[model samples]
Target chain A: MSEARLNTPISPFPSREQKQEERAARRAAVLRAAVRMFNARGFHATSLEDVATSLGISKPTIYHYLGNKDQVLLECVTIGLQQLLEAGAAARAGPGTGADRLQSFLRRYAEINMDDFGRCVIRTGEEALTPESVRRFRDLKREIDTAMRELIEEGVADGSIAPVDPRLLAFALAGALNWPARWHDPAGPQSPGELADLLVATLATGFLPR
Target chain B: MSEARLNTPISPFPSREQKQEERAARRAAVLRAAVRMFNARGFHATSLEDVATSLGISKPTIYHYLGNKDQVLLECVTIGLQQLLEAGAAARAGPGTGADRLQSFLRRYAEINMDDFGRCVIRTGEEALTPESVRRFRDLKREIDTAMRELIEEGVADGSIAPVDPRLLAFALAGALNWPARWHDPAGPQSPGELADLLVATLATGFLPR
Candidate 1:
């Protein structure tokens, strides 16, 4: 363990400032591994050793980067939520009507289903987290929900979309996007783009035969 | 463990007849406890002991009742899916216009949300099941999806609802109903009745000012 640390200081306990930078990089790497494991076996089924095994490191190495397993889960979920918000905002400038912009968001949303961030430990179970972690996740979700609601409202005001309840539509759209992670397979016939277009079409326009 | 078995007898399991019934009962009990835990902690985080302990039984007892942990998960999800299909059907009578039937289904769908069966473990993480289990769930989901699509088409044909893509509408409306599992709090401000009304209204008429 000591020799491993000496060759590659992956923790914050180095003798100098260089240690901190090394620690951050190590943490990011561990976080990446954590995302994959947690999504596969789930947060509870995954252990510190499982993570270390996947990373070709020792259990102590995990403490150096993540401190504890829970922290890794928190980081993965927090970072994912942050990315989703950014992606949603990025879609606001895309072409088409409010429905079109919303569609763009749906397309981005579909992409999340392919990998770990979309198949996250947090999104899969709220009951697994301590109240504190849940609160943190909820806070992040609330911000994104608010952003989405505003986008829906914009559609309504611009007369590009029907006047649906903004908050409801936002949540409704979110449910459709998020649901795919529970079942959609990347190797499956339906491409993400195809699913996104169909999803957006249903939400923006009603099922009423046009 | 042997002592507990004494009350039930192991002969021929002579009661092999009753044994089946008892097994069914034990299985249901395990499933109920599982739903509560899965709802609270998630399928992966919950352990076999957790299910047994909650039932005041031994771990082996659970194995006898359920083949294994995965089977329990499968059973619970299967139950949840069945309830939805049954309830959705009851909500809207068949042989009616697709729009009319779908609206009817939504009303019943909302009512089911008020029941524990509706908000069980399966709804939150059906994907947490094994591949075989997932295939079964998805196949069942497909059947329901097809029914909804047919209803959407009927609505389009009758002109009672807007003429739009029924395929897309099927998912969006279904998404709305399924989302309650993640966000709905039974003791919160809205009762199931209120929530159902809100859901039906949002899906049927939409957030549009009209």
Candidate 2:
């Protein structure tokens, strides 16, 4: 190589930060591809080979990035659950009445369920996971459930929400929100935000007129 | 043979009705066993052999009664859908305000989801069934949706229910009720009937105070 070429700021090889960013971007791409296929075809029906094929990469590359299929699934659901946990924490920490915070959290919760990773969380059954993974999945899910119940309890305590069984109410709300993952068509006219708002409105006001 | 035996009115062979009844009973037993196993282990993880073993019958016996695994799942979901349809019909035909009838159907809808056949319907995904069976399953589910929508429409027209999108409301109500199939414990202290009532009440009143 010429001295002038060597002295130039631009290098043929990627810097360490560039390499790390590229790796993170590639990992996210694989996860996105895997999660979408899993949601569309189901975990049992989808093969890692197909996910790799969709990404124009080799199966070994997927393994290098995300481990095995089970691990890919765990990662997807973990990301989704973490989003929910963060939403709950944000809502709790934000200003307004208890009901206001809960409503904000529920909207985000519904919207997340309609997204790629969150849809995977709702669509995946425990039977799809290895025993160890299933335990971890359940624990993460239980934390979200606890977070929801606490929101309900806070709302009830403040008298902003109706007096109801927090557990039952949480289940009802979660089920209503989780269902969009099953039935929502991304190609449909209604956007996830609109659908989430409508669902939350129905839950807040109920079937009965005020 | 004794002359008294020849003269007896009773025959050694079963009557045709007796044979029919026995066959029906056996088929029901097989279905019951299969649905329970499917709900517990999930449709993909469960096998006909395991179901047969649980009932002390052979796999062929299961096939003889319910065709194949996909067919068995189809039959199970069909039964559950039929129950929901019947509930809708009965509720519609009964004398009361539309809200009253809707609430009645909702309770039955929730209770049925906690039962064996209904739980199977909720747990068994479309991917688990054959393409043909998936079509049929979806058609039956659509019928139930139609029934629910009509009930809601009637309630809205009669001013018994708040003015809302019947389709969205049905989805919300069905989702809330459908979820118990995933989380409900038959062995738990709360009965299906009680849980159903609680869920229906939650949906009816919603989270906001009355």
- Best-fitting candidate, scored by lDDT: 2
Docking class of 2: high
How far residue A73's Cα lies from its native spot in candidate 1, in Å, is: 1.5
Please list the residue runs of candidate 1 whose C-alpha ends up more than 4 Å from where it truly belongs after superposition. Answer: A1-29, A88-107, A113-115, A154-161, B1-34, B41-75, B88-93, B121-139, B153-169, B204-210
lDDT of 2 by residue, B47-164 (tens): 9999999998899998888898888889999999899889989988988888899999999999999999899888888888899888989998998899899999999999999999
Q: Which digits, one per residue and each the tens of the lDDT, describe model 2 over residues A77-184?
A: 999999999998999998888899999999999999999999999988899999999999999899899988998899899999999999999999999999889999
| lDDT at residue B135 of model 1 (Cα atoms) | 84
TM-score of 1: 0.72
Per-residue lDDT tens digits for candidate 1, residues A1-210, read: 787777874665566667778777888888888888787666767898989998899999998777788777888888778778887888786677776676677677756654577668335566666789989988988887887777777778788767666765676667767766655667888787777776665555555434
DockQ per candidate, 2 decimals:
0.27, 0.83
TM-score of each: 0.72, 0.97
